[model samples]
Target chain A: MKIGVIAYRGGNVRSICSALESLGVELLYTAEWEQLRGCAGLIFPGVGAALPAVQDLQRTCLWEKLPTWDRPFLGVCLGMQLLGKESEEGPAPGLGVFSYAVRPFREAPRVIHMGWNAVSPLMQDPLWYGIESPFYVYFVHGYRADVMDCTIAEAVYGERFSAAVRRENFWGVQFHPEKSGEVGFKVLQNFLSICKSYQP
Target chain B: MLAKRIIPCLDVHEGRVVKGIHFQGLREMGDPLSLGLRYEELGADELVYLDISASVEGRKTFLTAVERIASRLRIPFTVGGGVREVADIRALLEAGADKVSLNTAAILRPLLIEEGAALFGRQCIVLAIDVQKEAPALYRVYSHGGRIATDWEVVLWCKEGINRGAGEILLTAIGQDGTRSGFDVQLIRSITSWAKVPVIASGGAGALHHFLEVFREGGADAALAAGLFHEGVLTPYEVKLYLHQYQIPVRL
Candidate 1:
């Protein structure tokens, strides 16, 4: 399948892209998205801070494209936060696809929820694939999304927040599957299947 | 309850894992890949591979090495060294690196942070700052692999990294590196207080208590150690046990 990634500044999604390549995907970058029109899927991975990253998206007009993309979109970590109503970290606005608020972990074990934790699907979310029980995905973030709708998946950090959210064609994971090992790889594979069956 | 992260950094040069004091006293320790896998099994929350060597052509080799490691690693891994442009970030991600870290490149081209954050999402971009106590009262940011010192205040640049789309700030105390004493508490706290983003405290982790100290007094969201974890001085699992004793939340 043909896949596209947004490698803006230092995306470094080698862990994920390599996994997808192992599954026979032809990966393209943000600058090469034009050639991905007929591609099979799209993934938005994160690496660094938030405000400036969104600013660059606006600079390249991608800030507008995120909410409107028709392909099967998978957002990881900050990628998922961008789909929220807004982020408290900076002045940049979010894509606002999910009815959620992305805010920092105020009082928990502390900020920067880092490590592998149990993720339970609220129901049988498609991204869970065929996992037997709650799976563990690697997560590293200070801010998490608070969605009004029942969260698709949740991980107990200081408190429970949305670990993964879904509305129609959009899927967002707060953890790093590319880094999460087997369960994470399953997430990508599931996302690929979703894209394959997407009408849009 | 958010799980506090424990990270380990390995200095990879010429495709081998090396450690030293001040990031210069280079000594061959073990195979980078073997050490990387060991850390993952040891329950390291995340792993960072900093390429201290500044070879332009070796950039591809670095990516290849990271891919080799990522193929076996199921945890998050960040690679940094000579990453300079947006395309470099793309190549690294495509090669299987979970995250790409920018130190020299971000300092040289500050705008690259935005491009990286926006396209891939800010969480994948790491802004690693090398800091040194410039004066009795202030710590200054050092770039160009910590050789050239810019007037940029470490605290100020940390805030800039967040504004530019970096999700994590890796604060490495240049003077404290490999000292195993502990992290620069004052520097770590200064940036953590100003920036809401997650900060990884690096450098000067000599004893296991040093990790707890940085997490407590330094106000770091995460603690990263090298020599101690490398030389059998400390293990991530043992540190978690200690953090649990202190009532600091950690993944067991």
Candidate 2:
């Protein structure tokens, strides 16, 4: 099955595309929704600032078109932040696919949690199919999403925050699975499998 | 808890890994891609590639090498060397580098740090400082690959870089570099105390205990080594296992 990775500017498109390609999966990396029609899944991979990222999505018209899509979707790093309603990192509003709000890490010892951290799964999900709880995943962000109802996995820096969240077919993780090494590759592989089994 | 990072630095000159002593003497190691993949297999948390190529043709070759490494290597990697302008930073990032470190460029014109941060976010801009202890408690910043000493003090430059929007600091101690005795714990602690950004302690890593001291005593967010790892003295996995025994919280 082909996966559609949105090609917004300032995103970590090369890294994610390379990772997915290594799995021997077909991909359509584009900004146009027309090219994404036949894909089994869609991925929004981001790096860099939030305001510019959201603005790029809006420029590509994917900002409005993305939330309406029913296919299995995965968001990585800042892409996961964009899945929420709003973020404190910038003035731009998120896609609002989930009701969560992203805020800066006020209580953490350091602002940017840039390293590998253990992920504690809170609920059973296909994303964690083979991955065990307390699994180490790579992260590089200063802001975090709060532990909400849709949080499937939680991790603590200073306070517990949403590590992974799933609502219906939407799956988002604050960590960069593309850069998390072998275990992270497993998470992406699991995501592709989830997309394959998805009916809609 | 956030696990401390173990980064293996690869000095690439004309697409081949080279061993540089205090950023001077160069000796060939192996191919960049293979060595990088090996490190990833050996459980390296991240990788840093410093392109030491001087000629324009060499920089092109380094960029190609970076693309090859980025495609194969799964973990994040930072690329630095001769990054003077915003276009330079863009070229490295577009070539698939996760972060671009600025040393001489940022030191010469601090506006590049602010400009890079504005264009490509603060997270990708790393301020790399090479320091040499001048006095008992005073350290001076070095430029031109630790060859030229500058008047910029360590603590002031670090705070200025952070204020100018550098997200991370890659602090290398010139005196301890290539010596392999141990990291300059005093230098690392001095910057980490005032700087809020993640400080990567580099140079003077001899034994496994040195790594522990940098993390526990120096309060470093990450520790980097080149000659130690390139010489087959210690692997990243072995170091992490050693750190785990000390409750340092490594990703083993």
Candidate 3:
């Protein structure tokens, strides 16, 4: 199946593409919605601030089309933050695909949480098909999404925050699966399987 | 809680991993991509590739190496060395470097940190400080590969760099480097006490206990070692296991 990675003009999209190529999957990296529409699944990979990413998405009209897109989707790092209703990093609104609001990490020993951390899965899903609780993954961000109803996995630095969240076909993860080693690669492979089995 | 990071730094010169004694007498190790892939397999939390060459041709070779490493490696990696202007930072990041480490350039032009943070976000910039102890609990920053000493004090420069938008600090002790005795815990404690970002303690990692000492006593968020990992003396996975036994949180 063909997968399209949304080009929001920022983040390590190259690494994501590289990871997918290693998995031997056919993929398309494009900024145009026309090209993405033909793919079976979509992956929104991003890094950097929320303001510019939101601005770029709005400029390309992907910001409006993504929330309504009826296909298996995944968002990574800042892309996960963009799925929230709004962000503390900026004075703008997110896609509101999920129920949480992105807020800056406060009361933490360090402002930016950068390094490896354990993720605890709260419920069963295809994303955690072979994963166990308290698995380690690489994380780097100053802002975090609070644990809410849609949160599937949670991790703690200074406080418990959403590690992975899902609602219907939308999946958002705060960690970089492409950069998380073996377990991370397993997560990607599971996502691909989800896309292959997706009826839409 | 966030697990303490075990970063294996690869000092690259003209696109090849090199070994040195106190930043002199360079000798080749092996290909950077192969070493990096192995480290990732061995459970390295992250990797840092410092391009130590000074020539323009060396810089080009480093970028090509970065591309090759970025394409295959599944884990995050950083690139440094001779990153001067905003354009250079852009080139490294565009080449797929997760973060760009700035040492002398950030000190010479503090505004580079602000500009890089503003353009790419603060987390993309890392302020690397080479330090030398002046006296008990007294340290001074060094520049030009520790050949020249600067007036900026260790703790003060760390705070200044953070204020200028450096998300993390890679503190390396010049005196302890290549000695393989132990880390300068006192120096690291001084910086980690007040500095807001994560502190990566580099230099003087000899045995398994040093990693535990830095994390438990020194309060370092991460520990970095070059020769110990490069020469097959220690591996990141073994160190993490040792740290875990000592009740130190590390990715296993």
Number of the top candidate by TM-score?
3
User: After superposing candidate 3, which stretches have Cα over 4 Å from the reference?
Assistant: none
Candidate 2 lDDT tens digits, B124-233: 89999999998999999999988898889999899899999998999999899888899999999998886778999998998999999999999999999988898889
Report the Cα lDDT for residue B168, model 2. 96
Candidates in order have lDDT scores of 0.79, 0.91, 0.90
Predicted candidate 2 versus true structure: per-residue lDDT over A1-200, tens digit per residue: 89999888777689889999989889999999889867899998878889988887888768778998898999998899999999998866999999999999988887688889999999999899888678999998988999999999999998999999998989999999988998899999999998889986
Docking class of 2: high
Worst ten in a row by lDDT for model 3 chain B: B19-28
Q: Is model 3 an incorrect, acceptable, medium or high docking prediction? A: high
TM-score of chain B, candidates 1 onward in order: 0.94, 0.97, 0.98
Worst 10 residues of 1 chain B by lDDT: B52-61
lDDT of each residue in B25-54, candidate 3, tens digit only? 889988999999999888788999999887
Fnat scores for every prediction: 0.52, 0.80, 0.89
- TM-score attained by model 2: 0.97
**Candidate 1: segments with Cα more than 4 A from true spot:** A1-136, A140-152, A156-160, A164-174, A181-200, B22-25
The C-alpha local distance difference test score for the whole of candidate 1 amounts to 0.79
Ranked candidates, highest TM-score first: 3, 2, 1
DockQ value for model 3? 0.85
TM-score (chain B) for model 1? 0.94
